[model samples]
Target: MVEDGASYWRRNLLIVWISQFLSLMGFSFSLPFSPFFIRDALGVSADSQVKMYAALATASSALALAVMSPLWGILADRYGRKPMLLRANFAGAIIVALMGMSPNITAFIALRMLQGLFTGTMSAAMTLMACCAPRNRQGLTLGALSAAVYSGDMTGQFIGGLLVEWYGFRQAFLYSGMAIGMSGLLVLLLVREDFQRPAPVIKTAETARNWHFKLGIVLSCLPLYILLMMSAFARSVDGSQFALFVEFLNGGVNEAGAARWTGRAAAAGCIGAMLSGLLIGRLLDYFRPSRVARTAALGAMLAMALIAIVPVHMLGMERVALDIGAFGLYFHDQAAPAVLALVPLRFMMIFFSAGLEPVMNVWLSKITPASQKGIVFGFAVTWRSIGWIFGPLAGGTISMLWGVEAIYVVGPFFFLALVPMIGWVLRKIRSRLES
Candidate 1:
C-alpha cells in the first residue's frame, strides 16, 4: 500500500488534474450544442423527432458509460489509470472532432456513441487521482476534482453556446476536439503511474461470509444510482425549462436571448456544484456521512418543490430567492459519494467512489468480499443502469406529456423516497458494524 504523505501531489496529482481539466473543458464545448445539431443540422422537423434524437444521443452515451465503465475500472485496476486516461482522451478527442463533420443524424449518433466509448477518461483520471493522493486528504483532493468536473462542464456549456452561435457547429466541434487532444498529450507528459501493491488476497469461502460488506455495497449503490437518475432527469430539463421559464417571464423572447440566458440558467448550478464539491468533503469530515447524504436528498426535494411552486411571475429579488434555493439544493447532488466515503479506509474511498460511479461497482471493492465484490457490484450497477436507462425517458416523456413543471413535483418525490431508503440502508450498515 502507498504510505500516507507520499509525494502524490508533487509527482502525480497536479498533472492528472491539469490534463483532466483541459479534457473536460474540451468536452464542455460541445455539450450545449448537441441538441441544436440533432434538430437543425440533422434535419429533424418536429419536437418529438428532436426528442427522439436527443434520447438516442443520450442513450448512446449512457449505454457506453454503462457498458464500458466497469470494464475501464477493471482495466485501471490491472494496468493503471494514466494509460486508460490517455487512451480515453485521445480517442474521445478524435470522436468529438468527428462530430463536426457528421453530415446527417445517423453519423452524428454514431459519432456520439463512439464518443461515449471513450468517455471513461474522466473516470480514469479520477481513479488515478484517488490512487496517488494522500489518504487523509482524499476528501479534499476528490472535492477539488469534483470542482474541476463542474468547472469543466460549465466552461464547456458556456463556450458551446457562444461558439455554436458565433462560428457554427463545425467550428465549435473543432475547438472541442483540439482541447481534448491537448489534454491527452498533457496526460502522457505529466501523469506518472506508480504501481499499487496488491491488496491482501482473501480466500473465496471466507470472503463470501462478509455479508455486511455485500449489504453495504448494495444499499449504497442502489440509492446512489437513484440519485443519479434524479440529476440526469433535471439535466434533461435544462434546455427546455430555461427557455420556457425565461420566455414565460420575459414575454416569449427569441432563441438568441433564450439560449444566452439559458446558458446562465445552467451556469447557476455550476457555482453551487463547485462550492459543494469543495466544501462537502470537509463537511463530511465534520458530520456523519449519512447525515450529509440525507440532507442532500432532502435539500433536492425542497429545491424541486420550490422550482415547481414558484411561477415565472416572480421578479427581481423574488427570482433571486428561488435561484438561491435551487442552487443550494443542487449542491446535494453528490451526496452519494460523500455517503460512500464514510465507509472505512480513506485511502481507497476516492477510487472506489470514482470507479463505482456511473456503474455502481465500487461497492465490491469497498464493502464486499473480494471474491464476490465484482459480482455483487456488477449486479448492483446493472440495476442502477436499468434505472438510468429508463429515468430520462420516463421523466422526459412525462414532462413533455403533462408539463415540465410536473417534473418538479415528480422528481422531488422520487428523490425524497431515497432519503428513507438510505436510512434503511444505513441501518443495515450499522447492524453489520455492530456484528
Candidate 2:
C-alpha cells in the first residue's frame, strides 16, 4: 500500500536511484563509444559512412522507442510500473549483450533497434518514481534519480573506455550487459509497488475522458514535451560522433587512444551533469520552473559556444601557471595537448544543458494528473525519441558535409532556439499557478 510518510517515498526513491545508476552505467558503457566501435571493430573505412552508420545505430533504436513507449506506458497503468521496469531491464540485458556479438555494421544497427524497442528503463523508472514520491518532494526525488544517471554514466564511460582500450568493444559490451542484468535483479528483489489499476469507464465518461485528456495535453503537456525533445536533440547531436571527432583530433591515432580520450571527455561531462542535478532540483522546488529552464538554456548556449573554440585549446588555456605569494595558492604549469581542453568545456556544456531536463521533468509531473502519469510520460518519451532520431542524423549530416568542426558550430543554436519556447512555457506555467 502507498504510505503517506517520508519513509515510503524514500525507500522507493532509494531503490529506483540505485537501479537507475546501474542501468545507465551499463548503457553508457557501450552506446557512448559506438562510433569508435564501428571504426575499429566493424572496420568501417570511410569517414562519411562511419558518421552515417553511427547515426543510424542511434536513430534505429530511437525510432523503435518512439513507436513503443506509448504502449508500454499504457501497460504500466494497467499492470503496474514494476513489471515495466523489469521488462525494460531484463530485455536490455539480453539485447545489449547481443550487441557485443554483432558481426557487421548492419547486424549492430539491427540490434540497436531491438534494444530501443525493448528497453526504456529511464522512462519506466521516472514514471514509477513520480507515482510513488510525495507530491511536494517529487522535484528532489527526480533530481536525485537524475544524479544517479549521471554518476553511473560517468563511471560506466570511464571504465568502458578503459576496457575497450585493454580488451575490446566485445568485452566492454559484455560487462555492461552484466551490470544491467544485475540492476534488474535488484529491482525485482527489493522494489515494492502498490499500484491499483484505474476502473474502466463507460462510453459517456470515456468521451469526457478523451476531451479532458486532449485539453490537458494541449494546455500542459505539449510545451514540456517540446522542451524535452529539444534537450534530447541538443545532447545527442554530437554525442554519437564524439569519439570520431576525438580520433580526428588524435591525428589518425589508433582507436585505443581515441577510446580513452573519448571516455575521459564523456566522464567529465557526466560529472558536470551530476553536479547540476545536485543544485537544480533544490532551486526548482522553490523557484519558477520556467525561469530556471530559461537560465539553463542560456547557460547552455554560452557553454556550447565555449566548447566550439576548444579545438584551438580555448585560446591556450589548456596549460597555465600561476603563483600566489601570501595566499598560499600555488600552481605550476600543467602542459597538456590542445585536444585535452575539450573535457572541461564539454563538462560545462553538459552542466548547463543538463539542468534544463530536470526543470521540464518537474514541470510535467506537477501538471499531470496522478492517474494519467504513465500515458503522459509515455508520450513524453515519444517526443524525446523524436529528438533522438533527428539529432543523430543532423549531427552526422553536419559533420559529413562541412567536417567535424561544424558540429561544435551548429550545436549552440539548438539551445539558443529553446529560449523563446521557454518563455511560452513560463506564461503557461504562471497561468496554471494563478488558476
Candidate 3:
C-alpha cells in the first residue's frame, strides 16, 4: 500500500531533496540560455545552421551520457550510491563551471559533452532515494523530487534570463556554476550511502546468446530513444519557430514584443510542468503506470497534432483552448514521473528504460541479476545514449524538410509504434518470469 505523504517525508527524503534541489537550480540556470548563447552571443543566426549546432551539442552530450550512465550505475551497484552521488555532484559542479569558461561555441559544446559524461547526479540521487524509501511510496518520493527539480529549473530560467539581460551571458554562466558548486559541496557533506552486497558477475557470452536477456535489454532501451526523438523533435520545432509564433501573435510586432511573448509561452510551459508534477502521482496511483504514460503520450501527440491543425489565431482568443493545449503538453511531460511509480526497485535501471532514475530503479531492481546490476545498468545507458544521438538529428531533419507541424503529426505515430513493441516484450518477459 502507498504511504501517506506525511509518513513518507523522512530524514533521508529531506536530505536527498535538499541536495537535488540545489544541484538542479544550477542546471536550470544554464538550460534556457544555452540556445540563446549559441544564437545571439555567438552569432549563429542561420536556421539550418542553428539546428545543426544544436544537434551536434545535443548528440555529443547525450553520447557522453550514454557512455557514463550505466558505468556509474554499475559502480554504484558494486559499491554504494553515496560515492556515486558525491562523484557526480562535485564532478558535475566543476564541469558546469568550466563550461562557463568556454571561449567559443565550439568550446561550449565540448564542455557540455563533458558535463553529460559526469552528470550522473540524478542517477545517484535516485539510487539513494530508492534504497531509503519504502517500496510502495516510490512514486511519491520521485514526485517530490520531480517537483523540486522543476522548481529549481523554473527559478534558474527566470534568473538566467534576468542575468543575461543585465550582466550578459558569460556572467550568467559563471553565476550558474557557483550556485551548483555550492550544492555539490553540501551533498559531499550531507549524503551517506548504506553499503550493499556486490552484484554477481555474469558471463558476457551467455547473456548475449540468451534471447530473453537480449529482448529485455532491447525492450528497456528502445522506447526511451523514441521518446527522446519525439521530445527533441518537439523542442526543436518550438525553438525554431518560437520567434515566428510570437510575431504571429503580435501581428508581426517588434523584436522586443516578440521576445516578451516568447517568454510568456515558455513560462506557461513551465507552469504546466509544475502542475503535472503535482497531479501525475495521483494519476499514476489511480491507473496502471503504463496506462498513465501511454495516455500522456497520446495527449501530447494530440496537442501537437491539434497545434498543427488549429489556427494560431484561434489559440490566442480561446483561453480554454490554450489551457487545454498547454495541459496536454504538461501531461506528456509527466510520462516519466507517472511510469516511475511502477518501475521495479533498483531505480537506476529505469534510466536504461527511458523514464529517468525513479522508473529505471524499479525496472532494474526487478529484472537485473543480483550480482550483475552494475554491468546491466551501464549497458542500458549506453543503448539509451544512442537515442540521444538519433533523436535530435531526426528532429532537426524532419523540421527542416517537412516543417514543424510534420514533426508533431509524425510523433503520435512514433508513440503508436511503441505499443506493439512494448506489448510483445512484456508478454515475452511475463512468460520468462512465469517459467
Candidate 4:
C-alpha cells in the first residue's frame, strides 16, 4: 500500500512537470520578442518609446503577479494546489490569446497585467510537486522540473522566432496560447491531488490573542524570501533587454536576421539551464546550498563580464559552421559572428545561474514547517514577482540611457552583491539550526 501511494504521487509529479513545461513553453513563445512586436507590428516608431513600452509591458504583468501570488498561495493551501494550477494555466491561455488579438499596445499591456493576475503556473506547479514528492527526493524532483522548464523555454524561443518570421507576431501569440491550453488540459485530465485541508481551530481567547505572535513566527522567514527575491532579480535583469541587446549587436542586419540570432542566443542559455538542472541535484546532495549559490553567482558574474567585452567578429565562422551543419543552409552577415559569440557567454551565465533557484527552493523547504509550505512558497513567489517587476523596468531604463550593452556591464554587479547575501542567509539558517 505504501509503495502504491508513492507510485501514485510520483506519477502525479511527472504529469505536473509536463504540464508546467508546456505552459512555460507557450508563454515564452511570445515574451522574448514582445518589444519587437510592439515596435514593428504596432507601429511604435521611436526607439526610446519602444524601449519604454516594452519595459512597461513586462512590468505590468510582474506588478500584478507581485500583488496576487500570495493570495493564490493562500488559496492553494486552503483548497488544493491542483485547482490553482489549472486556474493559472487556463486563464493564462485566454489572456495570452487575447494579447495577440489586441488592437493597440495599451490593450496588450492590460492583457499582460490580466495574465499576471490570473497566471502563476510556475509557482503553482512547484507547490504541487514539492507537496507530492517525498522529502528525500525533492532535490531530484525539482531539478527535473527545472530541466523541463529550460527545455520548454529553449524550444519555445527557437520555434517562436521561426513562427514570427514566417507567419507574423500574432500567429506566434496564438500558438503560444494553444500550447498553454494544452497544458491545462493535460493537468485537468491526468494530475491528481489528495490534498486535505487543515482542520479549523476553535478560536479560544488565548489562541485569538496570540494571532499576532503566530503571524510574527511566520514572518521570521523574511530573510529567505528576500534571498529568493534577490536571486530572481539578479538572474532576470538581463532577460527583458536581451532581444534589444541582440538587435543592437546586429548593427546593420535586417530585422529577421536579428530575431533569428536573438532566438539562437536565448536557446543557448536554455541549454545551459537544462544542464544545470541535471547537475544541481548532485551538487545539492554533496554541498551546502549557500556554497552552491555563491559559486553560481560568481560564475554568472564572470560570464556576464566576458559577454560585455567579447568582440562580435569572433563568432562568424562558428555561426556559418552551425548553419551549414544543422540546416544545410548558408547565411552571410557581418553581425552573425558577434551574435554567435553571445551564445557561449549566455550559456555559461545561465548554466551557473540556473542552479540558484532550485537550491534555494531546497533550502527554503528545509527550514519551513511543512504545513506552511504553500504560504512560504507563496511569499517567495511574491518577492520573485517584485524582482521581475524591477528587473525589466530597471534594465529598460538603463538600456535607454547607456545603451543595451551597458545592461550587461551593470548586470554582473548584481550577482557580485548576491555572493555575500548567500553567506549571510546561510549563517542565519545555521544559527537557527543550532538554536
| Candidate closer to the true structure by TM-score (higher is better), 2 or 4 | 4
The number of the candidate with the highest TM-score is: 4
Off by over 4 Å in 2: 1-7, 200-220, 254-256, 313-336, 433-435
Q: Quote model 3's TM-score.
A: 0.73
Residue 303 displacement in candidate 4 (angstroms): 0.4
| Local distance difference test scores for all models | 0.56, 0.83, 0.55, 0.82
RMSD values, in order shown: 9.4, 4.6, 9.0, 3.0
lDDT of 1 at 305: 58
lDDT of 2 at 374: 81
Model 1, which residues run further than 4 Å from truth?
1-5, 196-255, 314-387, 430-435
- Count of clashing residue pairs in every prediction: 4, 0, 16, 2
Q: If both were scored by TM-score, which would come out higher, candidate 1 or candidate 4?
A: 4
Q: Please, what are the lDDT tens digits per residue for candidate 1 over residues 275-337?
A: 566667555434556666566656656665555555422332222212224644642111112
> Residue 21: error of model 4 in Å?
1.5
**Comparing 1 and 2 by TM-score, which wins?**
2
How well is each residue in 1-435 modelled by candidate 4, as lDDT tens digits?
A: 021124577788778778878988898788889988998788888889888999899888989998998888878878888899999999999999888888989998999899989999988888887777766677777788888889789988988877888888888899999999999999999998877886776888876765565366458777878888888888888777788888877653353477777887898899999889878965675666778888999999999989988944353343443424346767554345677678889999999999888887877666655556677778788888888998888898898999878888899999899899988887767765334
Give the poorly placed runs of model 4, Cα more than 4 Å off: 1-7, 200-214, 252-255, 312-322, 325-335, 431-435
* Each prediction's TM-score versus the true structure: 0.75, 0.91, 0.73, 0.92
